[model samples]
Target: MKRQIVLFFALAMFSACNKSTKSNATQQPTLADYRVGEKWVWKYKGVTTQGEIRSEGEDTREIVSVDGELGMTIGTDTIPVADMVKPDESETPKYDWPLEVGKKWKFENSWTSQDGTKGTQSQDVEVLSFQEETVEAGTFMAYKIQYKGTISNSRGYSADTDEVWWYAPEVKNFIKLTQTQEDFFYEEELIEYSKPQ
Candidate 1:
């Protein structure tokens, strides 16, 4: 009777261990779990090419799908494809593709004026590479990403710039962004973010 009881107890312990292992295995991280529909309020701080320092701009964007389709608004202006200023046949937004490692995307962004006129300005970005890292807060996991890309904003003007982006995820959106372009470096943080009821 004693031997039989010991065997039964050992079997119960083994069953419990197996169940715990399976639960952990099913919790593996996936790209889709964290990189979709992230809204961010971004501010810009950098020097202009004309040697003037400016420190104000707000940017918001939503990745509508995992296939790289995005809706973005910068400073109350939406990017239009119909009227491209200084139409460059080769400028795109970096990360225009899905937010997966080893993936690439480009965006052709143009701006229009409030008066129903097209601004002679647009930006093209190309994503070269992407990487993710972890940061520390009080009791939360912070993810930071880096995007290397090239940009050209020429609208009958000689504004040529190349930049790299460093972004870190906030609670519900992008709270911080850094841009290093040519001879300019700028960083911005979220001042306000809200969802309409």
Candidate 2:
């Protein structure tokens, strides 16, 4: 259960979300863009090609105050808005800023699971389009970004992964993500979002 919880948060961190369609939107958000009362909710599920359900549930994040600093909740952690707004620190970051259609880049990451098995992910990422996308939560202009890559672990487990993600700038987050890796498949989508107007 703990491992699943961690993976859930990791997925959310790696895949960002939001709902307004500003056709020409660019520029990564800053800490100032967050508000304490803002909240985001998503529904996610993971399964195998064999029809086995690996996981299913909902995830939520909300901005709040912590020690006078703005904090965002994820699983059991409350991360500072300042930290959340910074560009990802990975050498081949998951996201390249000022995202635009036709933009392409490399994305990579290395991780050690709780069992101490090391793994690496290497992928080619492309922003395919900027257009309207609709999910259960609502409709917004979003970027259709795709990733293709391979993931391997020290234990000899490896799989090719292909993913498509839709990021909505008005909501400042990803509205949907679908991933396929070998026999495993995973999807997550935004279901609710609210903030003080």
Candidate 3:
């Protein structure tokens, strides 16, 4: 009777271990739960190698539902509208520009600072590539996504750039945006956020 009892306990322990292992094995990180309808704000700060410090105070971003269309906003402005994606219409693009590989979105306006600096600023975002990988950020699990493209400013100059985006599951936000252009680098962090009201 003691032997039978020991055998039963051993089988129970084995079953419990198997159940726990399967539970862990079936759990996987999924991006589907994250929605594009929410907007994110990135506050940028950079330090030059020459010891010069540059900073953009703070930026705001929002996601807008335009005429039943879905789109993103950056810094108190809307894409294709702040840039006027479609001119000669209702003051804004008639349709929301799709974000995808090989798709091109252009902003033909110049960028000027309040401090009297002027530059012909335009961003032609072509989704060159995108892929997801697993990364560890402290105690959080992060998905490292790389976005490669070119951004051209004034002087008819263009720079190939890549942005490393770390999406943390625990925070439900993009933790970092690392941009590199022609040996120059900048990084932005999500300091604050709010749901759309």
Candidate 2 residue-wise lDDT, 68-166, digit = tens: 999888778887777666677666887776677898999887777667788888889999998999999999888899989988888788889898888
TM-score for each candidate, following the candidate numbering: 0.38, 0.87, 0.40
> In model 1, what is the error at residue 160, expressed in angstroms?
2.9
- Give the best candidate by TM-score: 2
lDDT by residue for model 3 (125-156), tens: 34343234332223334444454555554436
List runs of model 3 lying over 4 Å from the truth.
Answer: 1-39, 65-71, 79-141, 146-162, 168-173
Q: After superposition, how far is residue 150 of candidate 2 from its true place, in Å?
A: 0.5
Model 2, C-alpha of 127: deviation from truth (Å): 0.3
TM-score of 3: 0.40
Candidate 1 deviates by what RMSD?
20.3
- Model 1, 48-96: lDDT tens digits are 5676675555545432332353332333443321221112344353223
What is the Å distance of residue 172 in model 1 from its true position? 5.5
State the number of backbone clashes in model 3. Answer: 1
